[model samples]
Target: MKKVTSDTEQQSLFWLIKTNSGRLSEADIQNFKIWLKASDDNHKAFRKASLLWRTLAYAPTLSEQPKLLEPEKKLRKKRQINSWYAVAASLVICMFITLMPELEQPTAPSEAEIVSTLELRTAKDEIRQFTLLDGSKVWLGAGSRLLVKLGSSSRHTQLLIGEAMFDINPNPQLPFYVQAGDADIKVLGTIFEVQKRNSGILVKVAKGKVRVAAQNQYRYLEMNESIHFEKNKVLPLPSKINPESFAQWRSKRFHFVNTQLKDVLHKLNRYYKSIIYIDDPSLGDIPITAAFQLNQLEQLLNSLSSIHNFSWHKDVYGNIHIKTNESEISF
Candidate 1:
């Protein structure tokens, strides 16, 4: 295999290997994003390398050598030589020979000995889903960051910021734990959602059961149960909740029930590029109960202003400003 010399190819290959190593930090992802957006050539190189990687991942491995006739053997050798030439040509476009040793005889990792750690993030207005090495599934909300560590003994996940829904695989021997701020949620096998709000962390169970521990206390919650935890204290007992509304953002519709105006804006900010400002501090505490499509943010704001007697305007920079109306209210 020829060595990769092009700087772009080399850089793309470097990122490809690092990203697949199952240990990417948040900073590394940000840097990779910047590099990917730097030029079209970089994007092309990365894509080419990714395609090669996929092809290699699907390539078959031989368990034993086979006997063949002289003619068949010569033909197989010729095809193998041609295939190598083709691979070399592709390598010139996107270098991947650095992974030759591993690619030559790829083997699946043993489930009992697997250990991997990686960070997952979604940009503004973006929602993403991932499957962990343990076969558990996760749906990450917009502008969210999650850290996942999978080991033979335990599966750990940290919701550093934002919200995520987990559909965990049944592994009684390997307990699954999620850390959201000060709250720690433990489960054997369950479906649940966790969100980090300005006030505190909220945990909602959709299926099975979970134990939430915070502020030196722990509570067990069953399906359709939810609880909120503040920084220093846990709220009241777990309350019944609608399991259907769990992670509604994935459906492009958000349901807010007696949610504060500030919290609403905080969620909308994840999908909206511009900033939303409430000029009157008093308005931030207003409780709102509504369900709106993700794309109807502007309409939602308009209705809120009209019902709450507030006036709103968008600046030249696309930022929105909401203020109390000076005129008298008819209602």
Candidate 2:
């Protein structure tokens, strides 16, 4: 196979996103495989494209937008929609390549251990669902980033930040794995949710058993069981949480049972994108028992404050600052 030109590399990226957009038919998957095998350069180009895609996917989570970093000339051209926006440049080229079979056979899927990663990301107020090639399903909460790497014999996912629920297809020969914060979970076939937080990682199993390992400690959890880990320490024993109730986030509903205020806010921030800060450090340790409906953030805040005696005010920048009533003063 010949080296892929920069133009071809861009085209490979175009197809990578296109094929993964959940609209691909069975025939499309087959055609994509055929096109991929047409050249070794195609694989190399797709890998490069995947890296760039992942980086751009993560860009939205940062506080500052990336537009300021571009050169003045390029920035102006961006407004014209031909220079930086020329990702479409490769569309026609790849369409034409799909018709050509002049190259060698692509790497064999069963024998080859492909280690490329594709990322899925959600914006501040967005939730998303992703279906992997192996029929595994993922539901990602807002502001979440998940990287999936499917090998020849195993399926794996890494949660870079935020939360996700996995509905994995049963494949004994190829077990599924997830890396969340400091912990790693392995399951053969199961429904599970993993949440990563500043304090630690939490794993909840909905169906089959999951093996969680962190800091040289290993624990197994069954259906209706949940565990939290902070470094090497696992919370006393697996707690019972109704799997269905725990997955209510799928419908934008939330349930917190004696959960810490900071942890609850951590989950809410993933969905709302609002910067919430506790002006009183003692408020961080407050335990919260609450249920919330999506898009009802104001009501949720008001209800929590009614009992907790903390007043929250929104700043001009849309950030919410919560301080106890004692700390509140006239503006």
Candidate 3:
């Protein structure tokens, strides 16, 4: 086997094999998480190694060995055998030369074909757009993480955190599914936005229709309809909303109608350089209606302070603190 020069890459490959083995205990997962968060280099190396492993695992193999040949052909045969051995050795070095014992090995070439996997992410203040292999489009919001998997029969995605807008291509034969928090959103073709909040998951439909399933119950939402699920329990009824106004964040502007102050602060924190702290927990539940560009956070907060009888001041650390005019508590 060829020596892997980079220690990070070698360790990443080992972890990848162990994770795919389907036998990791809870403690093992925690340790892996710690290792993954130790450095950006470790994360990148693991992603690279995972891609390589998946590609090789699904590659086609020779059906039969070549027969004995004449003297001249023996040299060619030797080179071919050496190449195969090299490939095998590399896989062994990665500790996944064959399928893990727990995994059922594929008996047919079709079953061995690889499913395409992609990981998409955005920086705290950045938004990104992606086009999947199936021609569906995704717009990931700031500080979001998404994992997409494309297979012959289905297109699936998981919104690990934050928000995304999906414009799915119509394909009845190949359905589209999104797993966000505890909710499962299924659709044939539609345009929708999904935001995973600290309190729940919110789904708003702009076009076509979608089925949101959670907690053994499901609701079908049509155009201009929206629903929120809390703790994996479906809401009683869907709400009517303006689709155009609901998606204004895609243009760097936001529209909020009767939104809680805490939720507003949570979204704005993704774009703000410093934290916005509400001194009183009860103040967070105050309903607020506002519309502004991403750059106008301070101005909007100032205007709200006068109307809501609240005062805000910046601490020495540059963090903004909001409190009611009657309270004198200090952080």
Candidate 4:
């Protein structure tokens, strides 16, 4: 792979693609077409420049993580056009290997198949953002799964599995809805968090209000509020939410404000798959108030140990063992 030594070459390559076939004058297009016909490598060079331009236009993230500039998906829909973009991208991109020497092209997809599906997924440990075929913009949490559909068929949203926080784009003409368990949360244009707990579900509203109807009952949860739906009823009026405490997730930290011990453990189990055993059922009822950065599993165990006489053990793989030897803690 040759290196693009200067910014001038880079800009020229950009202009080649920015100035598309339709953008050029017919006479100029004929002259350029003649130049392209002169030699095989000339066609190759123009193709590379054109592809690089288009790649930059579509996935601007390449500027930051330039490594992803390669078009891994097969160019099937517009085969002739996409192939030129891919090939041209490869050529100009190869030049940057010298000065910005860290860049390397990714492995090409096995074949070109014009892969287009509304289903959204992310590589492990990677977080992604994308607009659905519908006008909805979804911010998928790490390891989250999303399924959406759009077009004249009408707009709809379903939280297939895992956790996601949505900044939904509203359309009174096309109301957006989310299905979580038996409940259906309807919102026009609002920001909210929907987490699927083991038993039922948790809904938190940030900006606008959300209408939550579950199991034949419904409630309008207001801003800065959190509600849990369990046993076929929404929990009594939600206490005022602590905005900062909930934010621990953004920092990879877990926050609990009088959160039940059992519920706290559930969150830990989901985030870190450690075998947890609460031998003393009473401990599950005890309320926990603390903040923790989940980077260290032992740190959490140590915190629990401070308030209760609980035994904890762990393996090399971060599997945790929690159990109390006695029937109840001796206060």
**How should the candidates be ordered by TM-score, best one leading?**
1, 3, 2, 4
How far off is residue 6 in model 2, in Å? 55
- Please write out the lDDT profile of model 2 over residues 102-123, one tens digit for every residue: 2212222243675556999998
Candidate 3: which stretches are off by over 4 Å? Answer: 1-114, 232-234, 280-282, 315-318, 326-331
Instruction: Give model 4 RMSD, 1 decimal.
Output: 24.1
| Candidate 4 weakest ten by summed lDDT | 101-110
- Residue 319 of model 1: what lDDT? 83
- Model 2, poorest ten-residue lDDT window? 100-109
Per-residue lDDT of model 4, residues 93-181, tens digit only? 54443443211121212224212236676443344678765545676644556666453423445676556677877666555567767
| Backbone Cα, N, C clashes tallied per candidate | 0, 1, 0, 6
Pairs with steric clashes in candidate 3: none
lDDT of each: 0.76, 0.71, 0.75, 0.58
Per-residue error for 2 in candidate 3, Å, reads 56
* Candidate 3 local lDDT, residue 225: 91
Over all chains combined, what TM-score does candidate 1 have?
0.61
Give per-residue CA lDDT, model 1, range 1-331, as digits (tens).
Answer: 6543565676677678768878886656755776677689989999998887776544233323244547678667666755775576566434454533212211223566559988999999889999988889999999999998787777788899889999999987777888888777887447988989887888888899887766434556788998886787533467898767777888778888788999989988887788888878889999999998977878988888788978888888888888789843221
- How far is each candidate from the true structure, as Cα RMSD in Å? 19.3, 21.4, 17.3, 24.1
Q: After the best TM-score superposition of candidate 2, give how far the Cα of residue 125 lies from its true spot, in angstroms.
A: 1.4
